[model samples]
Target chain A: MIGTEIPVLAVLCGDRRPPDMDAVEAAAEIRYTDEKGLPDALRGADALFVYDFLSTAVPGAWHAADRIRWVHIASAGVDPVMFPELRESDVVLTNSRGVFDDSIAEYVLGVVIAFAKDLPRSLELQRQRRWQHRESERVAGRRALVVGTGPIGRAIARLLRAAGLDVSGMGRRARGEDPDFGTVHASADLVRVAAGFDYVIAVAPLTDETKGMFDAAAFAAMKPSARFVNVGRGELVVTDELVTALRAGEIAGAALDVFDTEPLPVDHPLWTLDNVVISPHMSGDFVGWRNTLVEVFADNFARWRDGRPLRNVVDKQLGYVPSGH
Target chain B: MIGTEIPVLAVLCGDRRPPDMDAVEAAAEIRYTDEKGLPDALRGADALFVYDFLSTAVPGAWHAADRIRWVHIASAGVDPVMFPELRESDVVLTNSRGVFDDSIAEYVLGVVIAFAKDLPRSLELQRQRRWQHRESERVAGRRALVVGTGPIGRAIARLLRAAGLDVSGMGRRARGEDPDFGTVHASADLVRVAAGFDYVIAVAPLTDETKGMFDAAAFAAMKPSARFVNVGRGELVVTDELVTALRAGEIAGAALDVFDTEPLPVDHPLWTLDNVVISPHMSGDFVGWRNTLVEVFADNFARWRDGRPLRNVVDKQLGYVPSGH
Candidate 1:
């Protein structure tokens, strides 16, 4: 038997219809609010789901509220929201970790194919009305190193292997398991392993150890023909080092889906590079992405109401450490 | 112990290189002829390998030689050179099959991902400096039907399955078993099975039965959201019907690697449509492709000289059917 007395739930964001809300509640409605409306919404709320990126923009009175028992962020990564107040609070924090796995994985594969098959060249030729038939490289039988073992990383690895690539993954702590994937390597071994791979993908979380991880030294260690893809936090890679690597031909190319600054400036040198493929951090934004977020929140809500451990619970000490550590 | 006397072989095309010529001459040295220099080169030839696209245009004297006991085509499909004179002779005919499998398979996957993720739209937005994020469909759990069971078709099927799609292949004759693939359907069942698939790929060879196989009726039977891909032969699909299908929204989109006429006439209406992605029949072309062809030819040469059955031998009755079927 389920409880009929629903706790007050506050949603922080614009009124984009949350996915699976009908299945989540018949009469258990959630109170929606913007940043200005947050204090009122959180007055008596027991749980909060933050969908607005502005929630962490300013320290709000809601953070001091003692009634809030759990906070759910409708994003795969919570690095931006990890403040000392939220980190030190007794409130449990959960993220939409699994939501973006497949979509982002698809994006990685799409970019890889685009580069390998010379789609950009084809597009350029099409504009000129030229019928050029050129041989392109094959994705098959190439070795790849995925430098993160989270859901998104694993998904990319799976898709790459399916395309006949030799895919290995790296984690914070290598367990030597993962039978479906190649040998799991430790982060310390990345530089040594990177040279043998044709592709190196960075999907690691933004941590003290991972920040600026792909620096000049790392790029210098990769093969000249290898490609680098970074879908993780932007700060995880050193932009200047990446530019140097590309300019010096240390790596063949690089694809960035995130940047140190949001809405990358038009004058940025990244847009000028022929080899770099820049995306506006939209890899995880798919047709039903909002619905997926709602579903995740609903599932977590049910777990919280039943006094069960919340799913995708963020490690406060590690500051957004993924589960299955 | 082997014979000390090397057999003299004539190559119809003069573009033979190391790996390819080496492959052909593993058992015997091959003397090649330019189309303009054919008579001199074919004088004392014991075997001939035809690599020219204009083989049918060759002078009558080259085909009349009784000393030429074997003939091999460098291309996969041998319909262009299948004259009644060549078919009736004791001359052995072989083809370069399985050489282009990985490249074509990579191309198919590339185009499929491009369509699924709206890469064209993304690129357009990138050019316009717009950061519009939209939902995209995932390739996982979707169904794909490859309408040909040849090496190219099977390779496409393998690659798609690896990307986590449910793939079914239809061949000219259903052998009922393919260890590398699943659910090999006969050609007659294609129309009935068309509706259930999310992707339809035409990879069948060009034949009397397969010519114009993808007509209005086939398009009508397909789901409105399904995407069609053709990499087999241009003649296998009715291009007019495809244009109509895209216009009427009978299908979501289509990517064509081959067309009824190549360099697909600039005035063709298909180019005007936003949903169509056209490639110049170059899906199988990739770096090192020429070398792969040479290896295939060389391997078959050893069997030919040892008085053993050659690989990829065409069955004249079935029009380029692989022998031993």
Candidate 2:
């Protein structure tokens, strides 16, 4: 525990940071800054709250983070903060895990239904005022393979099953029986398992083992009629292979929210693909999410002040919580 | 029942009709025709199976339908066959009920999620090759008012509820406690209830009381952020009023699958409206729906042969069956 002489907490924020963090303010002395001002702000701070998880500010400012003992990221994925130095350091790591579970589940379900109902074609016709009746596919009783056993993946599995899709989950291994997903398969089965499901959703975290996990082989193994959705890290998939597969009609379609390069360039082929659906990574951000982030940080701040074990502590070496540990 | 001699059934077909309606063919001596040859095809028919419900040929050949005892429409909406002469005739009108229920429900849930997830905006951004992050709304626990209590409406309600929407159904009357919808409200309460919900969906059959039900006054009652979805007959809503409501932002957006005049016309203002989604009156045409319609007709045909009361017998005056009578 740090000296209780009003412990200093450095908060990293963007322009649209949460308006009020009263619980955090009441518990600690705070300093906030964007990337430009981060190094100076990190001076004398015992704790760090990464409110801007997407910012490249962390690495640049890490050398000056001498007093930091506990680093909390307001994001489910700890990839941005798991640097080599931090992983080997004494600083504890925590993340916002449960926050985005339900919101992202809604996103996956939306994309699934959108594809099943031929909504893209409908919207295209709507643009031309063309009243062309077309037959759509049914979603119920269809098979779905969600390749992540985390809370977000489980939430999606539960909701998809409730909405009548036959859902199966895959994780690092078949880690005992899960109430939501019967038995999660190892990542090795992903390529082989691709053909059986109509919808293959990717929500796995980013790591050496998972990076570019869905490549040419996996796409080739999928049924020609199947669709893919990626709400996880952009690096989890090989964009070139996916593009080749889509162009060659190896798979029916793809709904890609996260991309290998965010702000996917104007010249990117994905922008013009007829069968691809793209969204700038906003699936987990529901209305008032900023406020929720603040609440999560504040709660953790209260725990830190009381010298209690922090919530959502990450198993730094594994790259994520064994379960948002 | 008619004479034991194989009953002559005139099957109305369009250019793209369901292939091999073997069930109907095996049960009855079927004669087929498009609009041009309908009159000659109906010359000796004991029963008329209006498979091409969209064809205007029914009205044109109604005067020559002297021997027609029963006119079975392969559709849920009987409006196409409910001509002035047919309404006054002794022909038994039966529809393909129960087939479209779940399919249309899937469509509704799709659009609902699309709106909540701001998927339209996402697609628009993708088209512009812009990566802009935006927060979306949660579909779970959001209230929805479904303005129909028929099978199609009930199916939508059930699916929406499963997808986590707080759903309520409104029927022509509160007939009884429905297992799926519980105590449904009267259609008269639609306007009053509209203000309380985030989504207002219309799936009612076309009838005198329902025609122009959703007009200026009804639109005014809806929340500013509310979205309207119409999967029912086009005439059930006043298109002009809907357009006006959309322009003024009386409601957030609309997903109109049916229109009073379809192929909604190239010069229609709705085509240019950014907040509207339109599909050509096909919310429930699943991949094998045509085959299912044939199976429904074949099943009803077998019952008719045994001299049993036909299922989905529409109440001539009311325009629809009372719970598939």
Candidate 3:
């Protein structure tokens, strides 16, 4: 039975609010607040929308979400929102899944091409006004291992395949015939099979089993000619092991978009590595992305208000939207 | 009828000779010469191979080629050998065509992705150890106009289209349908249709009629956001006009692998432009490319020896291998 009183919606925002907040205002009373004001803002809210996906205030203010029946984050990765209390609660969780797929896929392809063509070396030479000519590798016929079978990883696999790469995928389960990836290898066999590929890409969701998955052993297993790319969560890789691998030439190069710490401190050793390409976690953020994220939230909000099944509802035990549903 | 006499082959080389000159030694009497030795070497030669494609000695030595029957260049472009003396002569001309097609196409796709993702900026920021994150444009759905429709250009068109770009082509004539390009626009209509594209790529062969085609007017006609890429001969574009276009913001950027002058004088203004990416004319010179060139010439030599029709025989009148031939 639905309650007769008007439902309350709370939005946790940072300096910037979600675009077009008016779309949800008519359906529910909205309470907007910063990280510090989250507790008071969530006191009577029945549904919480995490507009500031980077904030860690939610876990601390979980006690105030007394009336909350659902929680949604404006990002594909829901790691920050999967706190112990929330996972133990009856509240449903959903994430912005489809929004970043194509954008991230494009980013991955860009970096892959960059590595094969040695674009970074060209740029470095450009800075010195040098006209040095070097032979570049062809991406066509090269092998790539995509370390996740989720939408983002699937998108990356498809784009890479389209760009003439022989691509395979690594997922929770092994399968022989996937539409995007013909062979899906189990994540457990990553180290054993990693040597066969020229490019290894990680787009896995962050979970207890996945944290620090790319350690020294995995790096040592990769061929010296291989390139490692991570557009997934930073904690998914062991940063020190990667740095050591790059220093020792265990891998030819790496294109990292995420790190354990944001803004990857200026003093970090990875900054000085010639073969490493670092991006500030902006792989999926294309122009007008913020507006699109807001629209996704509003559409989901309408469904919640009408008591309909939400899109992209996460499976708490699995820590992500499962393959089937 | 095949010639009964042993054919004399003159090889115009610089510092390096063809990798396996022994392969053709059994078929002909080989005379290896540098630019200065070309005239003496060409005397009484039945065929001349321009191993130093960069050398301009062929025209000067034309007076000594009393018995020369065929001239083959070790490069796709036959600009150096297309002089009045040779063009008016009965000597057959062939190029190392198919060898560089895929490599050059890969380079074109690399620059396109670099421009779309602003990888150059990312590298520059990396140099400064800055962690600035900027939203990048997606290459998918972006319109690209390939300026040439030969093998190299067709390869680029197909690869770019596969990578999710909407690709079209510019050729001598317009057609509603082409296997690689859905619509082939007339080269004469470049300015009129140039504005519709996000990228304008030049892979047209260097010929009298096509020289300096991408002038100020052509640059001005392009969208301000468009990027220009040239993997063709340098003289296909007017260097000064291109500099003006880039300086005045008529176009967003340029990736030039070929320039009007080899070595691109260190003082050239193009080296200073933040938006320009200058590579030293090595787009198609992949590893072992010289060996492949030798192999192609050897195969063509065998066909010549057997009195059979040869592959990649250029139509001197039109300056390239015609599409249907």
Candidate 4:
């Protein structure tokens, strides 16, 4: 049953195990393995299904991808899969794009409202059993600048707009009008755009143009009362500049789901900064996400079975899907 | 001048001082004072405006209400003004009901999303500089039961619906159909209704019928995974029962903005419970709220001067605005 008119998939997952593949099993010959067994399982596979995106096994197992024609990652971010060899190879790369839109939007809303309403102080006071009443900020009529025009960023913009925040968005270039964000701004205008917004959120991808975009100049351009959020890749920001901004009181506060260094070393000063909120790069993961992950893969598998052009294909050199696709 | 033909108003405020009353100063004689000076200030006044709602001066100053024709409190809850003499007096009573609607809705959204997304855990992890990624619960498709059909409660329901919650409301009785809440439920069926909802929020006012409504039986009726929120008065719940329910894990968690005691004792057991979140009764407050309070009172004052009926007239016997105008 080497080829047998069906594609063979090497499914690599984490300790929690891969999702049930019963629905897609009939169309593909799937062999399940943890990160450790990935190299052996990938030997002679026609496709790679990386269910556990955090696994570091893929780059090491690259040489063993004998006949693999395609690789699909069960995450929106392709940072873990951006191996030099894999990027240079002829293999097709696809991602789970729409799966996390709503959940991440909700997460961003949570952080925005938390900062606006001063929930942290409330929780702190609760722990101490102090009944000191304080005024909270209103979410309505506030201004926001979301930096990213991708699905996830747009979703965040939509929810914030619905909640009554005056919302605008920024992309690589100022392009077409978005139903939710209206005319997106060019990333170059960030410094000028930064001054008026009460909230500046970075959800752009990690690329040459976007890396270090949120530098000292950008932070300095923002209002003193403004807040910041990063749900995008960590490299999109200049970490030291952000820390300096907080220390100097250049901005009010920030909630970062991603950082310059992924496990942000224990000794890092960002850990102790009262004005910064640190979340372990988990704004996208939601309950029962694994099931949805498997469902997306299965949908793509059915398309691949009949020789259909795949959805969510990443342009290898560009590192992500092109705009307006 | 002591008993002038022009209407004299008594404005009682707190440490933040009275809101800017330039608009009303030209039309009416405004005498401003804190709790200490209110008794004397209330002398020969045509109207009383309790701008500093927290000051216990209103009750003490009630005996000196010589020429008082109308009283307007700058808050939704009338607990501070619900004194024996004021209740028995024939003077008109009105409150700033609609002013706090949107702000309290946003606060409720903050608490709901904070609990679902585990932002507290994120903050805790940040303190330790640990980048441990964890899955969070989604807000979409979650079921909610919002108690109280007043503007504040309905506003919460509308926003929650936009955020993708299946929301139902309960009023004094279950007769009419609400566009936002669909068919409202009877408060008597709360125990039965509590079983299915993921979130049970209390925004009902303090009243004879609603006092201590959420006791042991109500908590026991809820699903083990459910979360409770109280934006209503503290006396609406049995504090000891809520503490015991949280300890027994009958419900997953709770967030209380109002408690049986204004400054809940530092040694209260609820403070030590990890499953409960406590906030001082400031959910309706926002930045510049003092201005809004003053504006509401000023609007009512203009109406009073024109010999028109006041808005937000409370049904004293029932303790809140009854259904419809």
Q: Give me the runs in candidate 1 sitting further than 4 Å from their true place.
A: A1-6, A15-17, A23-29, A53-55, A58-66, B1-6, B14-30, B39-44, B53-66, B174-181, B323-325
Q: What C-alpha lDDT do the candidate models reach, one value each? A: 0.78, 0.87, 0.91, 0.85
* lDDT score for candidate 4 against the true structure: 0.85
Runs in model 3 with CA error above 4 Å?
Answer: A1-4
In every candidate, what fraction of the native interface contacts is reproduced?
0.51, 0.88, 0.70, 0.87
> Per-candidate TM-score, first chain only?
0.89, 0.97, 0.98, 0.92
Question: What tens digits encode model 1's per-residue C-alpha lDDT throughout B22-48?
Answer: 445556666667766666666777777
Q: Of the candidates numbered 1 and 3, which has the greater DockQ value?
A: 3
Q: Candidate 1 clashing pairs?
A: A286-B135, A287-B135, B20-B294, B23-B298
DockQ scores for all predicted structures: 0.56, 0.82, 0.77, 0.77
- In model 4, which runs have C-alpha deviations exceeding 4 angstroms? A1-6, A23-40, A323-325, B1-4, B14-16, B26-38
How well docked is model 4, in DockQ terms? 0.77
Q: Model 3 Cα displacement at A102 (Å)? A: 1.3
- Per-residue lDDT of model 1, residues A133-235, tens digit only: 8888988888888988888898889888878788988887776658545688888877877798888999988877788989998999999988999888888
B235: Cα error in model 1, Å: 1.3
Candidate 4, residues B239-303, lDDT tens digits: the string is 99998899999998998888887778898898888877788888888988888888888888878
Residue pairs clashing, model 3: none
lDDT of 3 by residue, B213-242 (tens): 999999999999999999998999999999
lDDT of 2 by residue, A165-200 (tens): 998888888654778887677888888778898999
State which candidate has the highest DockQ.
Answer: 2
- Residue A282 in model 2: lDDT: 91
